[model samples]
Target: MIKKALAWLECGEIKRLDWYGHEGNPSQLLGDKQWPQRLLPLLITGKLQMRVPSIHTLGSYQNWLGYSGSNLAVQNPKLNISSIIKTKEPDFNELKFHLTGMAGDGNKGHIWLLRLMQELLNRENQTNKEITSNLRKVKLHFIGLEIDKSASLARELRYWGRAIMGENFDWTAHGNHQDTIRSMAKANIAVSCSKAETFSMASLEAMHLGNLLLRNRTGGWEEQLLDGINGFDLGETEQKPGKKEIELVHRLRNTLITPSKKLTAMSIAANKHSQIFQNIKYANWLLN
Candidate 1:
């Protein structure tokens, strides 16, 4: 697929390429190690005009490729009909989390489920004790009906159910985009554990619908998601080498410690930030 796309960049007729970057790290995230080497020829020849979604990705590319060129730019991320999702009143009693994405995407593996499972197992096998009791208030909703159909995900979910067998937390999968939107509207937080992304549409849409996001600091996550104001950025803490899942789970528990009032304020800020995407479509912002 990449070969086919790159072929178009130098297919005799095209003068220059405006390559939009959507992946966080091609080497690690998308598992493509040779692309940077392949791109070097284009970069050196001044034929590749690289554009990325977030400021973070721009910086990352510069540092990774050591290319301090003038052909790169930060194109603002946008959403598609994001305002269709209606907002609802806050729910303080339970922490409802929504996670949505395509199931089979290589970088989009649902690794968070493993961290959650380890956390539950450490809490006395969901015995309704102090630790487990508090965690039971956490409900995770995996939106997009296709998630329920993924065989790979099914294996993780089976282990997930067994690990938290006696816990009261709700784990559900919804079928349609409307249902996904409704879930996001109702959720207190939205999560993404993708290894790499320029600026995830799920995170943007969730924020637009007034849901606090808990995601990594890849791409321009810092600019888009402000810690304690819009959402929590886990880039600094979650990416350590050989980090255990229990530690990740502990970080998740810490996120839940933020006061409900504070979270409400964060949600409001997220919604406000998302207004840019609602007003400006991606094509208009990128082209003209």
Candidate 2:
């Protein structure tokens, strides 16, 4: 099927091929073969145009072609931030944390989440006597909705999460985009644990909805997040427990200790920063 499609693409009078690489993509498959030799000529001669979502993707193509083309760069449609409204400030008693994506083994970082939740639970138990009443009762509720057909993985992860987090974790394997957005509005924090991404619309939507974002400092997120300001830079801590993971857990714990006013202010700042990716600005960029 991929060979036939590639043959057609090579022979067809197609002017442009806007490629978005994903798992099981034909371009990736063909690129591993000899598609670059066939496509590079067309690309260099301005007969074909290629656009990807991020510099990381562009770099991949450049490496495949053994040269960079003028047409290849990071470009993606702007997010519709119009539907996103500022959520009400969360109280200290219960704080909702959200993660939305495929529950696949490679995509979502479920293990990291389980570890973080365990750390939070341990912190609460250890500091129960020393903390204030509000802090003592504070609970971090994790709401995860799998957007792909990874039901079994989601179920398995949920079992582990429950073991680690007790009553604080919830997982849904079948969820639509609307359901995810609705849940995001109620969340105090939105986490993105993907090892790599082109452009994370979920993280952007979370920011637009005034949810504090904690995302890995890689891919398009590097362009979007302002470390320690709009969001925290989550480094590689998923494989093994490290300082970054500990710092993230500490920051979440500090949220319970911080005043509501300060947290609200931070949320507002995050929302404002996210406006750069709104539809209006995106449309203008397209026109220009």
Candidate 3:
């Protein structure tokens, strides 16, 4: 719809109100591809522009620059969404599955994680608690949906419950499901042990829900998580030489065994961080 709408509109001097400045992969939230290189010239000539929080500096450019020249930067770390109305928590009567991408894609291994989650469930008549103890209180339900169904990532997630978990895992491949966002926000904890994420909407949503985040230390998760506070970020041997991934995973797993005593404080921090991109405040900077 947006592509069609943009195609119909005349580009000459018309007011441009867009979230992304140029075409982005959509899989990642890093701003548009052309914006940085394109904007450099415009910025020089005084036609191109952007806004920033007083606290940010040009040095922050290192965060989002991919392995390319004229790389894009993500200065605006926080998102600005519309006001979030109070929502009642839905009864998690079943296991909730959020497979993010296609099975074969190297970058989209979160789909495989979802499959692993389902396989963990299907083993020999295990009760919900036996399969996933943390989620024992809630029923097990699986969901497969994304912004684009035709996307390879979306397709891999579609087959999650069918092939892996069998009939026990409920599958909803393509549909406009509004409940997903709200539910994600209400989850007890946001598990984003993904292989890669420059900036994760998943982690932010979990933060909004007052849920502890468990993620690796690469990418945006490292920037977001304040260790032993709201969440945990794992480390690599190179950074902390001779360390192991299993060790990091084990440490995080052990931490989750005990419910957080500082849950309230962490929740407050998460909520506060979420507000940075909640209102139109973020838009004004980019437009102005």
RMSD of each: 5.0, 3.8, 8.2
lDDT against the true structure, each candidate: 0.64, 0.64, 0.44
Q: Write the per-residue lDDT of candidate 3 for residues 1-288, one digit (tens) a residue.
A: 544433333243533423332212332543677634543443443343333221122224423332222222244455534433354443223323343222334453454345444444443235344434443322223333453644666555546546665564443443433455555544544555455444666566656666555555434654567766775554421222123433333233222543334444665666666665454244445544
**By the TM-score metric, which is better: model 1 or model 2?**
2
Candidates sorted by TM-score, best first = 2, 1, 3
Error of 3 at 185 (Å): 4.3
Question: What shift in Å separates residue 73 of candidate 1 from its native position after superposition?
Answer: 2.1
Error of 1 at 149 (Å): 7.3
Pairs that clash in candidate 1: none
Clashes of 1: 0
Give the alpha carbon lDDT tens digit for every residue of 147-216 in model 2. 4544677667767877776676666544566666777787777777776676678888888888777777
